[model samples]
Every structure is written in C-alpha cells, then in structure tokens.
Target: MTSPYNNKENITDKSSDVVWHNATVTSEQRAEQKKQKPVVLWFTGLSGSGKSTVANAVEAKLMALGKHSYLLDGDNVRHGLNKDLGFSDADRIENIRRIGEVAKLFVDSGSIVLTAFISPFISDRQQVRDLLEHDQFLEVFIDTPLEVCESRDPKGLYKKARSGEIKNFTGISSDYEAPLNPEIHVKTAEFSIEQCAEQIVDALIERKYFSF
Candidate 1:
C-alpha cells in the first residue's frame, strides 16, 4: 500500500528486520499480570505551588500502599538530564520533551511516575500528554495563585525574578496557562500538603491505577 502523500519515495519499510523479544518476563509484564496499571501523573503549576511537595507525598503514599513509583522534579531533572538547558522558551520545550520520553519509559516499566514541573506553556504540556495512552496520563494542576506562590517563594526564585536576575520565570517573567480539564486540581492555596496529597491519591485510587 502506498501512502496518500506525494512523497512516495520517502517511504521505507523496515518492518521485516524487526526482532521480537520476550520482555514479557520483566517487572512490567509481572505487574500487568497482577492487573496493576502504570500511570504518569504530571503535576503542572506556578513556582511554589506545592507541586514537588504533593508529588513526593503522593509517591510516599503509593510506596506505603506497596506500589512502584518514582518522581521527576523540574530542579532535579535539570541537575542531571537537562543540565545544559537554559530558561529560554526553546530550552523549556526541550526540557519537557526529555521529561516526556523519560516518563514514557517509566510507564513502560510498570511504575507510576510523578512529574513536578511548572510546564508554563499549554502546548508543551499537551505534547507530553500526547506521548501516553488514554487513562495512562493524569494531569494534576496545583492551582495556587501567583500571590500565594510569591509569598511562599520557597526557593527564592520569585525574588530573583522580581529583581530582574532571572529570565523566563513562570508567573513572573513568563506566562503560565491554567489547565482547562485536568484530571485533578489541588487548590494548594486552600489545602495543606497532606490534604492535597490525599486528594491526588484518592483520584488515583478511583482511577484504579493499582490493585489496592
């Protein structure tokens, strides 16, 4: 069959050389055999919106429930995989791109992965969501207002941004698009960390991401 495009010469079939492996013996298969579904919980919001806090706490809760999980925080990922990237719009997109691939790998490994990133741009966040299967991706918005985030300013980023020391800071120098239809919205402004974490966990439970 030919593609419906004019670039017929560009089409190449490499399907014959593909090899099959019985990775069915891996932990992913084992978990799925146990009827456990791996999920990517993406936390997006402004700085100091308690994204990292809630993600870490959620991971702890999942751990306590005897489930596999991991957390990918913005700062932590930057310290390693994305160390060379700056805060420019291009770098920000690339940063999220790398995280999206990593998160996909984690999901394939049968582990619930939580990502904590400002992910200010709606397009960038949508790109990440597009990498996963339906019901496998959960977008959680840490809906904390800018005023609250600035006041908390746990990392002093707000001060740097305000003083013109930092460039492309979300909610300070850059823009943050609120999620329109997130699977979970934790109003961090009105809730404690524990409460927020519990809310997220409950959503996961309701979604049946795990057996227990």
Candidate 2:
C-alpha cells in the first residue's frame, strides 16, 4: 500500500480519488474532554535500551493519574500489524511510516500515545514527528551505552546478532542514529527504571500536558 503522507519512502504511488475525511469533533474538543493534550511520546533507542520498560512504567503512572494513554511497542506491533515487514532499511522506513499514521489516529482520539521503537534512522523518526502537530510529538531518547544494552540483552537476539545469526540488527549489524536534541533524554544506564519513568512523567506535567 502507498503512504498518503508526504514522505520520501513512498514505495507505491499515491492512490487516486481517495478523499480525506474530516472529523465532526475537533482534536481540541476531544483533548479538552479528557482534560489533557493529545500527544505522541515517541521513544527511540537501541535494542535492550529499556524503551519498552520505561514506556510501560510511564503508562502505569498515567493510569494512576487517570489520563488516557496507550503504548505501541515495536516488538508487539511487529507480531501482528507489521508482521510482513523485515529489518531491511526500506522495511524499517515503512515500519515507522505506518506507525506514525497509527499514532496520529490515537492523537485525534485525544489519547497520549507512547511508542517504543528502536527506529534507528533519524529521517524515519522525523517523518513520524512531521505527521503530528508542532507540539504534539515529543521525542524521548532512551540513552544506553552499546555495551550496557548488549549486556542487558533481555532477548537473546542481541547474542545471535553478535554471532552473525541475524543481519540488519540495530546496534549490532545496523547503525542506530541517536537523537541530536530529543525533547527528553534519559540515560537508562545511570538511572533505575522507576526513576526514568518518573522523570518522563514529570516532564509531561511540567510541560502542562496534563494537570491536577
């Protein structure tokens, strides 16, 4: 399928005669009803960088505060929605492109969507950011050293990648372009998971994304 969004990775030509649909209610109205802003917390990092762990914890914190939120994890999404894709550069671009569209939908529904994806390429992540409003996308870099991520290897994929069993594996065979200036940068190697999560959640509150 072709991407409707203006992106460089459009594999197929845009379809003809597909009209855009306007929602009856505005995004501001939806977010006002939820008492928070519709935002996408895009978490980018290397494998085993604690992206999922930190995102899950932040989601829990949002729940406790009664905020509407959802998390789209990389592995979880690959299990189904993007099952057909691979780790090739082209496929990876397509992966984030599809995710950006999905996250835009969640934002329109007035929910804070947290996405956990290695998303190694800078352009791919920037494409996702372009899909949202100017202030709606917050890039959170889960900064962890290569050695630290490999050592933590929650999944054995890292070990396999090191052994030449897997190709195009981020941080092992593939390159991970770290964020130059992310909205929030958390060094997972230096902080506990709880501390990292709190730092993110607190940043949201301080930015007035949500208030008591």
Candidate 3:
C-alpha cells in the first residue's frame, strides 16, 4: 500500500532540522526501576473478536503482578490522537503507523504497552513490528472466524457493514490479513475471556517479560 507518510523527500524535509538527543535516563534504567521488561503486546483481529476484552483482562493481570503497563485501544485513540484519520486503507495505514510510534515511546518509557486494534493488513502490522526489537514486539492474534465475529457483533458494526451502512469495515468490506507467525494465537471462539487473558500472561512469563 502507498503511504503518504512514507514519502522520502517529505520525511527528509520535515526532519532536516531535527536533532537526536540522547537521554541520560535510558530505557534499561526505567525498566530496571519498574522491575519488568518493556514490550508491546499487539492484539489484532476482527472487531468484536475480543481484542479489547482480552487486552483489558491481561492488563488487569499484569497490574496484579505489579507490572507497569499501558493499553491503547483503537476506539479510545480515535477519540483523541487519531480522530483526524478515517477508515480508508491509507488512513488505516497512517493510524497504525502513528500507534506504532506511540507504542515505541511507551516501551522506551519502560511500560509494557498493550494495543488493541484490528490492524487488518499484514503489511501494516509488520511495519509496526519492525518499529521495535524482535523480543519487544509480540503479536497476539485473536483468531475468531468471521461467522462468529459477525454473530457477536458487539458494536453492531457487522450488522451495519452487512447492510452497507459502514464502508471499509474489516472482515466485511475490508480484508483481514491473518498473521503468519504470531507469537501468541487465541481462538476466542473456543476460549473464555479469562482463559485467553491467562494464556497471554503465561506467554509473557515464559518470555521473561515479567515475573509474578
């Protein structure tokens, strides 16, 4: 996909006067203080596939274990940071790009950032993964069949999409590109929300992101 934000000339022109300033208090120091490894838990799937549900649960679990964390839900971000963006493919790409940048900053600040977004395009998700170190980025795919998602339709989005009231809705109008090698995959259709959240917490523990 072509990204208006990726224009090399535009980027160079915009960044020409900017200088990098190294902070004395580094990410490592911040993480050490927090007693947890900073990382980004990116949840991707169709809307109503339980991304936010599972993410909120996982964040609660992390907090109970004394891990510093933050959650950036798609709808919440749209209310502020990404309100100017839209549902077009280009706008979606820009949205993910901006979120990826913000998540990186959160990681740098020593917080395990949990992002709940549809992030339908594999290329867009991959772009976000490339923003962080390999171990710092964990793709959590909430795998629910479209039929199940449509049936759940918590926000009435699927119904709207089916009726043509919504355009470019993922899984209905837009294509949802499944992750090829996600670090964790939760089949939400088969698992309870608590179970899915616990599974992610276990994965984080196994990966040594934090200790309980």
Candidate 4:
C-alpha cells in the first residue's frame, strides 16, 4: 500500500503487504443522505481560552439545527484514547496526529467533528489539515489573550503551571504558535459564548453545510 504521505517519507506509515480497503458506501453518499457536508471544526487556543466551551456551544447549536456532530475534547480524550501520551513536544504532536485521524473517520461518516485542543504547534495543525479535502477542515481560532486566559483559569491549570507544578504548559513553558490566518477567528474576550458559536454556525450555514 502506498503511504498517504508518500512525499514525506519520514512520517509515512507504509505496509506494502497490507491491502487498502474501501467502504461499500462512499462518503458523498452518506453526506447526501444526511443532507449535510461533513467537516472538522478544529478549535485551537491556549488553556482557558474557551476552546471547549465554545465548541460545546457550537455542537449544541448544530444539534438544535438537526445536524449530526461530535466533539472531541482534549482532556476527555486524554483520559481514554490518548491516556499514554505525556506533556512532551513529541507527545503533543502525536496527540494531534491521532486526533486528526479520528476526525477524518468522523467526517467520512458524515458527521461534523469539533476538536478542542491547545494544539500549540503550527506544523501539527497543518498536518491535520493535510489529512482532509479542501473544504473538509476549517480552523477555528479562539483568540483570547494570555492575560485573559490566565485570569479565567477555570481549571486552575495556569496557577499550577505558574507555581512550577505543571511542566510544558502551552503559553507558559511550551510555545503556542497562533494561527497566522485561521478560517474562523473568534475572540472570546470580546464576545459571549453564544455569539462566538453562532458566528461559526453562521459561517457553516453560509458555506451551505446544510440548508436551513
């Protein structure tokens, strides 16, 4: 089997002996049946930046609109699927990589997936984008300032990270490369959760994800 990333030899998972499988029903068929365009809404930001909060709100809105959707929250994922991953840079990259593959699977099944993760690295986020079609992935940047996030610190993570209790925290010990030009940018500091979520839903509706 040819590697998905044939050009990037170092990261390609090759298995010449294994056969590539195709589903009997195609993704387009599934999407048509659901009357929606499946896509991944990737929410990236620093801790306490309302990634999860806004994503949850968006998912709720999608639900109310009768669209099929799923949310993959970072902390919840680490508790199960990514339990073995640590706080190292390599682990962080692997975490996003795995999540990207999972999001692709959801998209294939005609469901909109919202992933809420710090996803601090630009390269890692780009890798996820590469896994999907042109319109299959939309980057949603929750642009909350460091001061605002630190002040909110809903999980007390910032306090711990500041006190040297947590290592490799994004926006602190680790680097958070903000999206240079994300598809959707929402500043939680300036807007309410409903407004931010509605902004995203409006974008998808304008994009014709589903006819209202």
Candidate 5:
C-alpha cells in the first residue's frame, strides 16, 4: 500500500527546513504604494451590535482612499476555515484564536485586516491583541447597549436567543466582557455607522498607523 513517491526516501535538512527569506516587496514598498501603513482592526462586540456593519464601511472607506484592506467577517469565516466550530465557550475561544492568527498573517503581508466578530470574552480579545505590535493591533470595541442591539436585531438572532431557541448567545445566555481599555470604543447606540468608521480612521491617524 506504500506510495511510489515514498520509495525515493526523500529527506529535508535544516537549510531547507527554514524558509525564512527577505521579502522582495518590503513593507516600505507596500506603504508607499498604498499611502498607508497596514494594521489589524480587531472589532469585538455582541451580535447585532453593528460590528460587521462598521467594519465593512471602514474597509470600503479605506479602499476608496487607495489603501489595501480586507475584512474577516465572523459569519463568513465560520462558513470556511471555522466551519466545524459551534457556539460553546471553548469553540468561541478557538474561533477567535484562529481568526486572530489569520488576521496577523494578513497584516504581515502588508494589507490592513478588518475582523468583525462577537468576541464577547475580554480574555479572548486580549489574546488576539497579543498577536501583533502596539501600532499594528487596534482593538475596537463596538459598545452597543444590550437594549439597542436587541431592538436592532438585524438578523433576528436576539429574538431567537431570548426565546431560548439559541444557546450560548452573547449578551443573553452568555456574558459579554467589556474591554478595560480598548484602542477605540464605538458606542454604536449613540453613533451612526459612518460616525463609527470615522472614529476608527481618526484613531488610526492619531496612532500614526498610517503614513498619510
């Protein structure tokens, strides 16, 4: 049952094992082309709290400004890389962990990464923050009040969660741990989606995370 390729006894040494090499297109080159430095905008909040809304708007704005960027929406990612994960606490943590690693890689590739997820646990959010440099990781807490999120209920999830149809729902069956000191906290209850995107862009500019 052995494969024909295994009969050759192929072996790899230390030199080949280490694939580290200088980038042909450096970060500086990317910055110059995009007119901005790349970073990971880690958006954390409860479902129906406008995390994805704001993240999408921010990415669109960045694109209009000629910046390279991409968004890692929770629902979208779950359908792909994290398809097997469920809504349990442990699954939530692992989901954030995988997304964080992927976002960090996107940042390293000289592209701004916008991640929108209901990362309810402060610890899980902090774990994602620890994956990047101070200027590279921007923790944006979409502080939408429970009442506001419930009222919005864009996806009807809040109603299902409250009716006991859904389990481990953040801000409902599950607890949401607010960030102690996030880089940017958008109180969505009081601000429009455009306002939230502007606030995030202002923070990025203030931090000098973008050259222009």
Candidate 6:
C-alpha cells in the first residue's frame, strides 16, 4: 500500500487555473464593522505548559469585551481536519501549514483567532508567521520550563515519552526550538492563568490591535 503522506503531486500544484476571488466586502470593511482588529494569537509551548488553558482564558476575555474571536486547538483539529497526519516530522510540518492557511482565512474574515498547539519547531512557527501581515501575527510563547511541564503532565504524555512509549515526542525524543524573540512570552510558572491571559490582552491593547 502507498503511504498516505507520500503524495507530492498534490502538495506542489499551485496553478493559475484558480484565480483569486475578491470578496464583495473587504477585510478592512469587516474589521470596521466588527469594531476590532483581527489577529492570530498563536500559542506555542510544551504539552501541559498551559497553552490551551491560557488561550481559552484569553478567548473568554476577548468575548467578554465583545471582540469577535475563534480558537483552533491541537487535539480538536486532529479529531477532524488533521486526522490523517501523524507525529512524524513531515506530518507535523504539513499539519501546521494547513492550520496557517485556515488561520489566514479567519484573519481575512476579521476574527481574532487563537491557536493553541505544541508547535515545537521554530521554523514551522515562522512559516505560519510569514503567512500573515506583520502586525497580524502575534507569537505568544507559553514560556514554561521543560521540568515544570513534565511535572504538570496533565495528559501523562511526558511519562509515556520518558518511558519510550511515544517516539518523536517533543522535549524528549524530538527537539523543541524555543522562540528566540517571541512577541509575547508568558511564563506560566510565575503567574495565574487569568494573569497570563490578561497580559496578552494588555499587549493587544497596547499595540492598538483593538481598543478597550
């Protein structure tokens, strides 16, 4: 049987047959109508580092403030859009690439999209960053120490990785490239989830991504 991931033809076909369809209403119009600046809040960190926790909290805050927002989480996506992809390096790259495209659509629609993933590779994260405009992509690094992440181990994934039950596991069998200069870095160990979420909101406000 052929490997599902070995199809290169489908990946390389960017033809002119499909012209870009201009939407009747532009992104700026959508933003103006919604009264908020659209952005992709990409949260990257180790498993159990509170990426999902803090991201959800931030989304809640955004909603309470009447900002339009959506969250794309790792496990949730895997259950559907990325079900075919595995933990292999190539699969991981493709997974992030597809998500970047989806997030770009969300931004075009003028919604603040929060993505919580263990997106371990810096290059992959940078690729997603390049997909958006300069100010539209906010890299929020959940900067928790590896030891702390292992201790938290909410899913017991770290324990499995340590036991060699899970291969290519980030911060264990696989390598995780930390962001050298993320736009926002929240040290989960130093603050409460609400505080971390507020810190992100404060940054967004300070940058004038949205007011009040």
Clash counts for the predictions, in order: 0, 0, 0, 0, 0, 0
Distance from true position, residue 149, model 6, in Å? 0.6
Question: Which pairs of residues collide in model 5?
Answer: none
Determine which window of 10 residues in candidate 5 has minimal summed lDDT. Answer: 5-14
* lDDT per residue (tens digit) for residues 58-90 in model 6: 999999999999999999999999999999999
lDDT of 3 by residue, 125-173 (tens): 9999899998999999999999998898889988999899999999888
Winning model by TM-score? 6
The residue pairs that clash in candidate 2, if any, are none
On residues 1-212, what C-alpha lDDT tens digit does candidate 2 reach at each position? 75445454452344444568898999889999999998999999999999999999999999999999999999999999999899999999989999999999999999999999999999999999998889899999999999999998998989999899999999888999999999999999999999999999999999999998
Order the candidate numbers by lDDT, best to worst. Answer: 4, 3, 2, 6, 1, 5
Q: How does each model score on TM-score?
A: 0.87, 0.93, 0.94, 0.93, 0.86, 0.95
Question: What is the lDDT, from 0 to 100, of the residue 52 in candidate 4?
Answer: 99
Worst 10 residues of 4 by lDDT: 5-14
Off by over 4 Å in 3: 1-12
* lDDT tens digits, residue span 98-189, model 4: 99999999999999999999999999999999999999999999999999999999999999999999999999999999999999999999
Ranking of candidates on TM-score, top first = 6, 3, 2, 4, 1, 5
- In candidate 1, the residue pairs with backbone N, CA or C atoms under 3 Å apart (3 or more residues apart, or in different chains) clash, namely none
Q: What does the lDDT read for residue 127 in candidate 1?
A: 92
Cα lDDT for residue 97, candidate 4: 98
| lDDT scores in order | 0.88, 0.94, 0.94, 0.95, 0.86, 0.93
Q: Residue 12's C-alpha lDDT in candidate 5? A: 42
Candidate 5 off by > 4 Å? 1-29
Give the Å shift of residue 82 in candidate 1. Answer: 0.4
